[model samples]
Target: MAVASLIPPAPATGEPQSGCYMAATSDCGGRLSREHYISRGLIDGPELRVRGMPWQREEVARFSPDNLVARILCRRHNSAMSPLDAHAIRFFLSVEAGLKHAQRRSLSRKSRFYMTSGDGLELWAMKTLASLYSSGIEFMTPEHRFRDFEPPMERIVAELSSPNPCSIMTLSLPLMQDAHEEQIGRRAVSIGPIVDDETGELSGLLVRMHGIALVFNIDLPDKDALPETEIARPDMIDLIGMDRTSRIFLSRAKRRPEAWIVQIRLSHPRKDPPAGRSDRGCNRQPLRK
Candidate 1:
């Protein structure tokens, strides 16, 4: 549980104004490199057109380099995490293919995909969360304390450099239906607070990329401590050898655009309690459809 303070104290007067979000020490030297919010290699093909939430608009548009690029990490730190980007790309590609296959089958059947490097994928999720958080630092004010609040940069850097699977939990699902398509892309990356029945605080980060949604929860509580009704569990197909699997299902109707349903099943079998749990933990917000 080596966690870093999400927000660092304001930088010193004479020091460099910005530093690498991952490393938290190396000054960009007034030249910060562009880091893709979503890996470029993952969306290079035509089928997967990139889309992002526009700053002022209520809709999502084709993602442009400027829209998704963030000048957060220095050259050295950015280069160090390249392998993670590649692993994440591969992991998502496998998932996309599995979803496509499930859709093509047009049956209420189950599908499972293996992740050879779960730690790598977890780090990728953490990196994306950190990147999104850092990109919006300028817009934050004292009143926006929730937005400014985050785990420490040093801890994040440590996780990105040497990820620990026990530190954070990650789950992924596909956007099967277009019912919320407009809102989905508009909310590409969002970080917020999740409060439990006892008013305990936890952080939630959601990242949607290429029709897939990845959700991360820090310091999740044990499942057995909460009632089953207060927890949301999706049907998951187990991956062979690995303890966890990314499960997907498609509706029987071939003509329906909402035929697909995807979910990320973690090995731990526990998740952060649902948002807004009353004293009895009777009412809970839906984690996903």
Candidate 2:
């Protein structure tokens, strides 16, 4: 199985040369500004960084609030999306609060968590997808030929902004046990394709931060065909908080013989032991059957 790189290279230093990614218009001209690749409100604390496929073997870099930015949107267009940013922040903060509450109580049973937003969450997802796609195009080089691998920006913008947007799924699980030192409270967005056993494919945009994951699937075919798991539906805002049983289920599901697989880490590591141990944050290897 061959895998393609969906992650974009770091931004280069230069004047804004690209058009607005969201509106896809050149009318904005020399007014483009640096836009945060991920919303700032969702991240907390100082050591903000991400690591995984494409980012592997790289030093655990630190990202100031302005680090993960691109000159894609004009000030006017960027300001227009503030409401969506607020919505996404609200959704993420709520999830974080719930996770903290669970940790404090050491809850061992299933509990319900709900968040309400009027299409803001969808818009936020759309904005993220557009930003990532635009950033990839701007930073493309001969060595990295990603033009054919990525989805069309026009098509993505159209579908995401439409009344009936593509399917967006959200799930909450325990903080990944093997999480990198700088990943706590940090947010990262990754894009790729998921190919199932039947050769069916779905373009996936994964946005994860603070123990919550949001997956947006472009042009998903049949929900029935997907593996029977608790994937939060596009219309459902209530989530099943992660617990022991669900954790076990997630661990097993990822190892299933037939599954929908993407080249990304979807499972969290087992909970860590008390601090001060050498292997405290080390990922617990999966048990062999």
Candidate 3:
């Protein structure tokens, strides 16, 4: 189930046409170019493993990161998304580094904190969702459905490109639970959509990577809707059982005025795909640190 207002409906059948999905937007121009719906930076080395996508027998297979590209956005629109991709890349890199440090025997509590632009993270999520749709992936996928629907592409684009901040979605982490964390392999990544039980509209998107999982809401709720004290609305479904997110701001301290702050949150143990989420065998080499 998708929220109304995606692309224009076809003249004969009234079905949404996938042709140049972003044609209606003013920011779209230049030649149609390949866009990595999923940031290539998220890929380490040359490839990454994916599961739960149709066409795979075991629901798991490795593909070169470049294979994820699609001729979705025009060259200009796609290039405009570079900053968001960089933010997301910095975030994952920071996560890998922090995780390695956390496992160190002589870890210090003070070293756990990090920071990045929350706005950039949110934009990354929106960009990811738009790219998926533009790449021919439907919002009403087999894994999650109510009624067939499509999102308002223009609105998603406007929200993503606009300068003013908006609460399009929230990213959250599970409250700790190593019992489940230990089961999820660091290379695991899962994504699925969510539908509103009542409205039957595409409500959110769930993305689980490594041990941590995050959900990005689809409705684009008001930034002020979430009071500073609350992480998520009680009525919002716990799509990934990891919704405890809160906003934080920091000021430069005299001790490390030159250093920037970034917050790295990790979660694990959510339900894995049909393929399984167990750690890789000891004989197999890790994809990356």
Candidate 4:
């Protein structure tokens, strides 16, 4: 494949519908601001690398965290939603910290532990989806691209501004890998639209990078029989709460990984593991025969 240098965002579209793309009833009184398309604070590094974008065209693009921003949110709305970014950062960092601790300690290569809130992380993914569409950028890849991506803008605004934002969303771990079965860049994150295959419409969004991968299913009426993901997974991420800032634990391990497999299998439907069993994986895969 080829590597491309990221060009800057096209000049503003000069459209009348400016100000804040994320505002609904709440007024957009605050100054218009550039929202980091990929939340900057979540980078945890001086720079970030992005891949699989329309402009990059199957090429990897490097960016200083600040350079990857888009002017989409107002000061007030942006500030109000700052918590969303924090939540994503927490979830991502927890995964990072857990892995680091395990590596430093020379613990089992299979697993490590960490904590985060599911609801907030979901919102962050939604917010990221909003950013991607609102910026008017589309995936140029034929299969993954959305040329007529009609985003659910109203739902996005309502969910983001709501005091307890929770709407159509499902979380999953995508085992991101190349044809070579090698992990994509794990040091950074990428946000993109998920288009429905049959309808060719925008479905939801995928927020993934490094060891931390999450999918937000926004378009489906219900998360049933989600298409199998050809991505990577962390060993185990057990989410207990959906709408509140509850502490969730993710004790991950390197499972029997293969290229393009959605490794986080929804496990033991509602039933706990056998009492004495040491496993506590909410996202555990069923044992293979």
Candidate 5:
């Protein structure tokens, strides 16, 4: 689709459009600028760009409301708060193609950011891996899974991929809020494993990511109070205390991965049996047991 066709006709000079868009919220401040759901930079980024153009425009155009969607925001919100929105939009674009790219890289580089080899973690990661796995929710994907952890990944992904549920326009705050509430009780309420080095055993709990649990330490108070010692199994990660400055480390094997599959790409050179062949897989097919 022509880039111009993707962009909505410019609101005639100053005439504002209806605020019916639910993704838009009323800003008491002033007129909002036309924000590209996907960052213009990302549209022209290195990994995704080809010949100075995004190959995914065709895919993104499908989601673009008139080539671009406009939401009313005050200058503050648009410039300040909108960074999150901008980042999220880019992530959505990346994951569509990046997921495959990330997976290929994992096979070689091995990322610790959103992967685990333990059986218990397979189910958790499969369920929560899609959401931003970093301690803080910075990234987002179109497949924002882990909204609820009670259901299995297959069930949830199947539901999400359905045409009815996949439309971005159909999503609203109330719906998202409702889904979040439902998952509160069922969200992964435990830390799977903790792999730590000399910088004190990094202890973090697994919260839902996309639809998986990414184990990262929470930066809370009293980090200095915990004993700086090493532990064996990740199960012992829980033993560590939570405190301020409880640094959360997101370890990614390859900074530039080729696909998005979340599983430990064993880096240990000792290939006794093989890599990606962990004994602690789960009964679920998503977990690869």
Candidate 6:
């Protein structure tokens, strides 16, 4: 379940102030345009009054564009990945905002209850799936964050890197265990017969994109009722990977404020998109840190 907002809060006066562009020069060696830090879509009509503050408060230092280091990316580069960048930026903004406004007590209870479940394996699966949806992953860029790869590129790498041979198997096993413990008051095995230590190591499996780690864990099933294999299976990979879906659900969640995006885009002209394609596409990515 996702919180209402995605973008985080604004920076306090003392926090480090920097632009998203890594190189702020406007030389002819080619220039890069800064993307908006926050998407206008995420902003409420009245929010135009809050200048310079892209996020709410409570956002981590890393997610702030003031602290982000932008790099020069060409037009060809930008167009090829525009959809993902736009979506990611939006997603980042929404998530941060939600965290800042979320009921602190409710969040604490959810964390505590989930933590007590002895099913480390399930926890691992949840973290993996969650990473893909995490705000950090949505706000990433190739030149500045990923360097050689785009945000989704890294997600692909991370998922493929899981040590477990079967992605579905890797995700399902733990989920069954977690659902059992959470829903049914059954105490799962910790070491011997109750738990499968071998599966515990799978928890370490992660899909890291940009600077954030996308992790997942499974929910245990009811002991008397074993897990339903169909739901736990990875049947939605194809749909989730689509450009449109990623942009809507994943990207919008991490968008930065318009001011921030403008600052980053214009910081370096060398990073501008190619001659022909300037604005197009509607895909998105996850953005949170």
Q: Please report the candidate that would top lDDT against the real structure.
A: 4
- Model 2 lDDT on a 0 to 1 scale: 0.44
Q: Is candidate 2 or candidate 6 better by TM-score?
A: 2
Which stretches of model 5 miss by more than 4 angstroms?
Answer: 1-27, 37-67, 86-283, 287-289
Q: Tens digits of per-residue lDDT for model 1 on 1-289?
A: 1222222233512334365674444322345688886676665443334333324243334454444577877655566567667766765565555434433434333435443344455666677667766876332222344344555456666555442322354443322333123322222322233333354343555555533355555544653443332331222222111122234321111123222122322222334332121323222232233
Off-target runs (Cα >4 Å) in candidate 1 are 1-18, 23-31, 46-58, 105-116, 137-146, 162-202, 209-213, 225-289
Candidate 6: misplaced stretches above 4 Å? 1-67, 70-72, 97-213, 216-289
Q: How accurate locally, in lDDT, is each candidate? A: 0.44, 0.44, 0.50, 0.54, 0.25, 0.24
Candidates 1 and 5: which is better by lDDT?
A: 1
What are the per-residue Cα lDDT tens digits for candidate 3 across 1-289? 1111222222322222234454554445457787887778875777777654544566568878888788877655566557778777766655555455544444233334344455566667877876776677643355564225465667876665454534366653333343123534377555666676778677766676655555577664653553232233211111121222121222111123132211223343322211112222211211111
lDDT of 4 by residue, 1-289 (tens): 1111111123422333355775454445456887887888776778777766667754567778888777887765676677767877877777555434433433233333355555566666777777777877766555665647767778877766554466456566643332211342256566666777887777667666653446677644532456444222223343211111112343222124321122221211334332112443323342210
Score residue 113 of candidate 6 by CA lDDT.
Answer: 10
If scored against the real structure, what TM-score would every candidate get? 0.55, 0.56, 0.64, 0.69, 0.26, 0.23
Clashing pairs in 1: 4-152, 5-151, 5-152, 6-150, 6-151, 6-152
Residue 183, candidate 5: C-alpha displacement in angstroms? 30
On residues 1-289, what C-alpha lDDT tens digit does candidate 2 reach at each position? Answer: 1111111222422333356665543223347788876777765666455533243356344566577678888675576556667766766666555445333445455443444462456556666767766776432323343333455567655554343444243232223333222333334433333323244333555555553455555554655533443232332222222232111111111132332211112223334321112331122222110
